[model samples]
Target: MRSSDVSAGLAEGAGQAAAERIRDAAILRYGRDGFAVGLRAVGADAGVTAGLVLHYFGSKEGLRRACDAYVLSVIRSEKLKATTGGPAVVIAQLAEVEEYAPIALYALRSLQAGGELAIEFMEQMCADALEYLEAGVAQGLLKPSRDPVARARYLATQAMGSLLLWVSLHPEFHEIDDFRKELRQLWDEIALPALELFSEGLFVDRTMLDEYLMYVCDPPAGDAKP
Candidate 1:
């Protein structure tokens, strides 16, 4: 390659490296301090000049968008691979990304703070989750609910709540693996029971439940019971 081309390639590599460093710093600090941390502080944490940070991300909000995109992409990729296992697969995959706990915490903090970006991010996640649920149904891995959209919303809300609770309890544990093990155990204790209930269903006897349903609620308008 030409010397100029080599120089360009080196510059591009260095720029990408710097951008990633800045993002990591932002994620770590944001997890601890939320959006209150300035871009200059993130630049300082990354050992890069504030000007370079701006050059790479345009603004603090832009950097946050980048961070959100990165974290969400990682999660969605794992979720896609876990589709066959349903929500349990997704939970298992969460344990694999423990190294990115800072990013996970940052997402939770962002969601809790609530704004246009937070709402948009959450909306995107719920939509992605719904798509995953639809795929699971199609693959015969998940049972179809009478209202898939509502089911998706409930699952998304619970998943997010679980992450927040995990992060809240994380500092009490000394070791990462211990925390992960505990989180997995907790998931089993909680999520598994919920899944079992869903699979086993709510009513003990379908005939009795159907009788109650027909007696307590009106039938179809044109097909009301005589």
Candidate 2:
């Protein structure tokens, strides 16, 4: 290639790198603060000017969309890792929970913000969950679900709902200076019960489920309620 072409290619690569840095910094900022955080603050965190940020992302909303996409991709990658790697890999990942703090906090902030973006994030999460859950089943790490899509949605809803409830119950969690510490505390408190319930299950038998399926979900022709 000519000298000019080489310089243009190098500049394009640098611009892509800078844009990625800005996107990552925005994730950390939005996770720590909220969506209301300004582009200037994100630029400061990214070591770039706000004008550069705008040039790269077009607007704050564009930057946010990029962050959301990146966060969702991270979530999918990590969950797929767990699905394919099994319990040992999961335990190892948990040991390095600090690495995930920013992503987790960003997701929490999105949910806490509560709007169209939050709903979109959640729907994407559910879709990703369904993908990984199917992978788990294929790998024999998880049982096949009768309604895999519904099961994925239910799992996502249950996990997020429980997290929101836990955060609401412990307001001091938000006051913690270290986001990683807060996440660790939350994991430490819930890990045992959540694992036990998921592994051993809550019900001693399937009587309740059987009855529900029989009476509620698919009642006899004449047994329908008014």
Candidate 3:
């Protein structure tokens, strides 16, 4: 390759690196500050000029969209890794859960913002959940679902809803100045109960499920109950 080509390639690589740095910084900042955070703050956090942030992302909204996509991709990758990597990997990840604080906070902020973008992000999450959940079923780590897609969507919605509700109920959670600390505290509180419910289940028997399926879902022919 020509010297100019090599220099241009190097410059392009540097620009991409800078853009990723900015995006990551924005993720942490927005996670802490929410959607109302200014671009200058993001740039400062990223160690770049506000003009550079705009140059790469065009506007605050554009930067937010980029953050959303990046956060989603990171979550999808991590979840897939956990699903496929077996119990040891899952345990190891849980040991280092602090690493996920920024991503989790960003996701919570996105959902809390509430708009078209949030809805789109959530739909993508559900789709990704379905993919990984199917992988878990294939690996025998998770039970097979009669309606896998709906199950995946339901699980995603339930998880998000539960977290949001917890945060809402404990307004002091938002008073924490450090995002990582806040996430750690939240995880410490919820992990045991969530695991118990997921593993042991809430119901003692299948009677409720049987009735729901037989009566509510697909009732027997000529059953005049309705």
User: TM-score of every model?
Assistant: 0.74, 0.90, 0.89
lDDT of 2 by residue, 1-226 (tens): 8999999999999999999999999988887778989999999989999999999999988998899999999999999998878999889888887778888878888899998888999999999999998898888887776578888999988988887776667666443247688778778887889789877889999799668777766543342121
The order of the candidates by lDDT, greatest first, is: 2, 3, 1
lDDT of 1: 0.76
* lDDT comparing candidate 3 with the true structure: 0.84
lDDT of 1 by residue, 45-137 (tens): 999988989999999899999988887776666665677676666666655654555656677878977899999888877888888777877
What's the true lDDT of residue 45 in model 3?
88
Residues forming the 10-long window of minimal summed lDDT in candidate 3: 217-226
Tell me the whole-model lDDT of each prediction, alpha carbons only. 0.76, 0.85, 0.84
Stretches > 4 Å off in candidate 2? 171-177, 218-226
- Pick the lDDT winner: 2
* Full-model lDDT, candidate 2: 0.85
- Separately for all candidates shown, the number of backbone clashes (residues 3 or more apart, or on different chains) is 0, 0, 0
Choose 1 or 2, whichever is better by TM-score. 2
